[model samples]
Target: MSSRRRLGARWRRHRPLRTRLAVAASAAVALVAVGVCTAAFFVIRYELYHQLDLNLTQSATLVIQQHRGEAPGVLAGECRFQSAPACAQVVPADPAKDPGKGYLLPVSPPVRQVAVGARNGYFTNITLPSGEPARMFTQRIGLQDKSLQVALRSDAVRKGVGQAAGLLSGVGAAGVLLAAALGYWVSRTGLAPVARLTATAEHIAATRDPSHRIELPPGPPDKEDEVTRLAASFNTMLGELEQSVTAQRRLVADASHELRTPLTALRTNAELLARADRLTPAQRDRASAALGRQIREVSVLVNDLIDLARDEEPTPLLEEVRLAPLLAHTVDTARTHWPATPFELDLSDASATLPGVPARLARLISNLLDNAAKFSPAGAPVEVVLLAGELTVRDHGPGIAPADLPHVFDRFYRAEQARALPGSGLGLAMARQIARAHGADLTAHQAPGGGALFRLTLPSEGGPG
Candidate 1:
């Protein structure tokens, strides 16, 4: 049983959708046709037999009425050896007086038994001595001493029923064939969209092109079908895939370009250190420090590249986090990292909360603070403000150039003024990515007091935790 079920399942799966649909429709139509045809054939056969039985009964009645005044034995004598359209027979009720002569249809024991037992006329089916089918009616004739039997041949009825049944069978077969052909046409028409979808998917797969998309046929806007929905979903998925591929390519190209300068500086520094005896102690110390700084720079750049590359990672765990405490912590950490640049905090008393991943939010705050501190002049204060779910960081330094303001958040984008800064340009880019992931926005502009201001805004209402 299990093996048979498995085989059926395999057959269904391997079968084409159009073929399956056609077969299913055809089978349903055939079943209904067979049932209706079979019922009609049986009804026709019953009606034919009923009509034949009525005619035989009427003939028997007519013969009795015609000989109403005759003696019981005289009626038997009249039918003796007579060949009529319908066969007739008579038997004497009195056994001793019975002539025992044969007539057109000889009375059998079964017919006599029926006549003896019956109070009135009764009909039955029988086969005559000649091996032909007939219907017989038996009853008493003029008196109690005699009985009569009348029979009609049923060969014609049988032939008519047989022909009708054959005709019904032929019609049923024709109907089934027509139903199958119609089902095939309907299935092909209905599944045309699916066929097109399959072809497009195969082409994309073979060519390894994520840019390929399915175009929907023009139809009524209100008539949204499964095929249309599926095509739309496929196109959306392809668009996302294309964007991801483009981002990946851009990351590789940018990383390669960014690594060249530090790598070259490291090589130069290493050569100078290799000639230790030819250099002064101060020069050797400087060379070693420069090499170490270059290594740290390269390490930071590599780490930033990895962080940016993981664009498809699952979203980090989010929880309702209080902005005040997290921002304070980030500022304290930034102060430890950049002791020369003082950070002044101006936080609101109102507690601001939002749904966010704690670590990512912290990283975003740290990057904004670090960016401000890096551009600020020595001994200048970097102001940090948190109010009404919005955080603003301002640095007292030369503001960003107007042309560079738009692309400050772009990956690996360093403006002409800040190109000499010792940091990978991925900080602002990663900050913006994290902000977007947490359903917030980050923007940069010139501050009121001739410095750059970066503002981070969070939704006033919390999102899913």
Candidate 2:
């Protein structure tokens, strides 16, 4: 088969609902029309034949009457006349007188030879002189001396019946054509909404634009309708797509901003070290020390960047932590760095229980103490409190601005006072992350005595011992 033919056959086999609906509707109308027309054709033909028989009988009766009244000697042979109701069939007044004329009846031999019954109606099988198959009607007419046979050629009646049937068939075919056209148009109009939806979907696929939308025509809004629900679902999908795209763009922008600072610092320090040989001994020593410091800072920044990039969440591992001992250890380490800065610890009720990772909890406490020691003046005391399940660290240095408190735990974020400090901004952010992993909360606030207060709260049970 040709490609087009094969494709058409495949489509028919698939039989999509719209095409099937149209075909079925059209076929039903055609079948009903044809059936009704066929029945009507048969009924009309039967009635025509009945009326034709009555006409033949009436005409034959008139011809018999004329034969009885006519001048016998003058109209002896080949009698032919047209009168009321038109009489065509004629038989001689005496059949024996014209023996060569055969039976003198319109019907051929066999049926014409048999006399019509008392009922005055009989159909006969016959053959005309033309040798055509025909049916005849022969009826006796008049009374006593007027008695005669009348016959009619059945071929003529059959010809008329055939003509009627042909006409009905043509009319039926025309009706089917009209019905098919009507059905196609009605189906197309009814399915217009579906066509529009298909076109809109194609456009969406081509453009890949989630912002575009379809407008529904005015009607009663029903949630139960499948097409309406599909439109609603598509709109919801577009909303989620927009949110996801926006979030991705924001993340990219934030990552770019955070990477720029470390890169600039690394470049500046490397360029300064390259020019070290031309300087005097004292100047060269200062430059070498500055280069080492910058190198260490760059290394720290790079490590922190890697940590941020590889931030895999750890699974929760609940364990008891001893806060007082952990704080004392952290303070002892802080003293080596800032011995002049007074460290005061109050851990009377520090045995409160909490669920936490021990190493991370210790790191959280150490970061707070380190921040306090670095920011406070030499003689200023850094007060540490462990009460119930709460730990507080306060520094006498300038406190963080109230406006910046909310953003303290955000990655790579720092207040104005903390920007010149030695630590990266990620310290507080990391502390918060560790605290949250163990079902605890961490917050930054202002201490009453003009310093920053960092508060860490854990559950009473499974908290620090």
Candidate 3:
């Protein structure tokens, strides 16, 4: 039994979803139909038998009233021998008083009991002498120990019940057919969106193009269905992927353009070093220094490119970062990098913490400080502060131009005035990327006093309220 059930379950699992749905609908209807038919069959059968019994009871009563004062022998004289569906007979209270058994209905013990008043009157099924089905009613008359009995044919009742069964069978079969059809139609209509989605996915897979989009299924804007949600999510993923690919292409193109000047300078300086004997000692020293500076420039550019690109990729994990010590440490490093420009450090709320990758956050802080220090005049202070879960870095150079404020954090963007400086344009852009990845926002504006101010705002999830 268990093995059979397992096999059935596996078969059902393997069946096509539409077929399973249709079959289930059909099976449910079949069960209901069978139940209704079975109940109706029994009810019709009972009612048919009941009608026949009513008629038999009426006849018996009439017979008892008609022969109320007569002797048992007088009623027995009217008996019909071999009556096809009906006959009458009597049994006296005393067995000897009954007519001979040869020409009368058989006297059962119950019939004898009715004659003697030992049992109440009742109806029962029997067969007449002619071999036809019948119902019998037996009752006692008021006369002493005298009783009346009647029998009626019941073949018509059986025929009526048989007709009802046939009618119900036909109706049940029609209902099952309708149920199966409706199930199939419903499954087909409901799965239409899924079918279209499958086809669209296959097209995307074959073509390797995310430019294609699925049109939204028709529905009210406020009522979002499952398929609609899934399609929307897929479209969103495609948009992000397209943007990432575009950004990568832009990064590569910009990197190549940026590398050209340093590469040419490095090649030219190397050629000069190759002809070392042709030049004097002082000139040779100058060439070597120029070569070293070009090498450092190329190195810094490459590192910045790598950092900017890596920032766009998702960080898989993070740890809680204590902003106080991290800010202090990056500030010290920036002061060393720009020793000529003094830095003013303030850690007001020293215990502020937020969820972030520690190393990335440190790099972000360093980039902001370095950018500020690069723009500050010698001996001018670059003010740094960490208070109330926010960090601000302000420089004391000429404040940012109104036009340059918006593009400061854009990749490879350098204002005309700042083009002569010795730094890649990726520092601020990379800083912003890291800030957003850690659920923080980085924005730049002209400082009220002078120079650029970069503010880093942390999310409230982990930072101090």
Candidate 4:
């Protein structure tokens, strides 16, 4: 049994989807067909038997009534002894006497079991003396000494039932065939979309093309089904994949370009150090310092690239962060890093708590402060303001160019005037990425007075009370 089940399961798994669907539908239809056919066959059989029994009862009653006034021997003359239409017999109460030649009925054990005083007529199966199958009913006549039996030939009833059974069997076979054909048609029509989807997926897999999309034909809105939704989801996934691939290519190209300058500088400085014996002590120190600066810049750039690439990693741990204290700590750290640059803070008393990763949010604030300080003139104070749920930073240096405003947050982007600055251009970009990861928005615009203003807006759920 277990082996058979395993074989059946393996067969089902290997079957095509459409064939399975057709088979399942056919099985369901076949079950209903079988039930209806069997019920109809039995009902027809029962009705045929009921009609035969009714005729036998009427014939038996008539025989008993007709012979009520006459002698029991009189009924023997009414029916022919060997006729197919009717046959009669008189069984005497005394078992010793035999019912003679006029009796056509074969005295079977069932007929002999009938009692003389039975109010309802007794029915039994009997064979006629002429060797035909018949249905017989026995009833007591007015004379107490004899019982009358009447029988009709059952050959016609048997023939009719046999014909009907054959007809039903044929109809049942036709119904099963029709059900199979209908199931095939239904499976084909219903799974048409699935077939198309499979073909499209196979084509994409073979060609390694993300640009190909599944396009369903236009149909009524009410007709939208699961297959349609699945196709739509597939197209959406393809679109995202295409965008990711394009972004990765761009990142590689830009990173190569950015690393080229620092790498060239390091090589030049190292060449100078190789000829250190021929150089003056001061010249050697200058070359060594330049090399150190280049090395630091490369390290910072590489770290920035790593951070940007990992922006889409799994979500970080979240906790309620108090914006006020976090901003104060970031300002102090920035002040320590650039002691020559003074920092001014204009913070409101309203305390805001936001759900975010503490380390990430701190990095975001530090980046904004560092960007402001990098562009600020020596001794110029960088201004920080936190009111409601918005944090703003302004640097009183060369403001961003109008054309450069849109691209400021783009990775490795720098304006003509800012290209020679001592920093990689990933600060604002990383800050914005962090902000977005925390469900916040960061934007840069020219301050009304004379510098660039960067605003970070937290979501309402994280806003001040």
Query: Which candidate leads in lDDT?
Result: 1
Worst 10 residues of 1 by lDDT: 76-85
Per-model TM values vs. the true structure: 0.75, 0.47, 0.74, 0.81
CA error at residue 164 for candidate 1, angstroms: 3.1
Misplaced by over 4 Å in model 3 are: 1-15, 29-43, 50-98, 101-150, 236-325, 350-358, 376-381, 396-425, 436-439, 449-451, 459-465
Candidate 2 colliding pairs: 351-465, 353-462, 353-463, 354-462, 354-463, 355-462
The Cα local distance difference test for each model comes to 0.80, 0.66, 0.78, 0.79
Q: Give the distance in Å from residue 300's predicted Cα in candidate 3 to where it truly belongs.
A: 5.2
| Best TM-score among the predictions, by candidate number | 4
Tens digits of per-residue lDDT for model 4, 252-280? 88999999999999999999999999999
- lDDT tens string, model 2, 1-465? 699999978888898656766777788888888988899888987886777666556665666566654321222223222223332343333444434534433533332233322344465545545555444445444432212443345566677779878988998898799778866876676555566667767886898766666565666766336665666676677778766665455445655675577567657656766776766778767766766776776676666555555443355676566667877888888888788898998987766655566677777787788888888988999999888778889999988787998888876687888778776677777777777766777899988969989998876454423
Identify the superior model by TM-score, candidate 1 or candidate 3.
1
Q: How close is candidate 4 to the true structure, as a TM-score?
A: 0.81
Clashes by residue pair, model 3: 399-451
The total number of steric clashes, by the backbone 3 Å criterion, in model 4 comes to 0
lDDT for each residue of candidate 3 in 1-465, tens digit (9 for 90 to 100):
999999999989998776777677767877787788778888988988877777776666666656566655424433232242235655577877865544344567887788778999888877666676667778887657856667776666667878998998887778777777777876677666666677778987998776777777777856977867887787788788778878888889889999998999999989999999999999999999999999988998898888787756356576778899988888888877888989999999898898777887888898888788777889999999888878999998877888888888888988887899877788889888888878788998888867888889888776322
lDDT, candidate 2, residue 49? 71
| Clash number for candidate 2 | 6
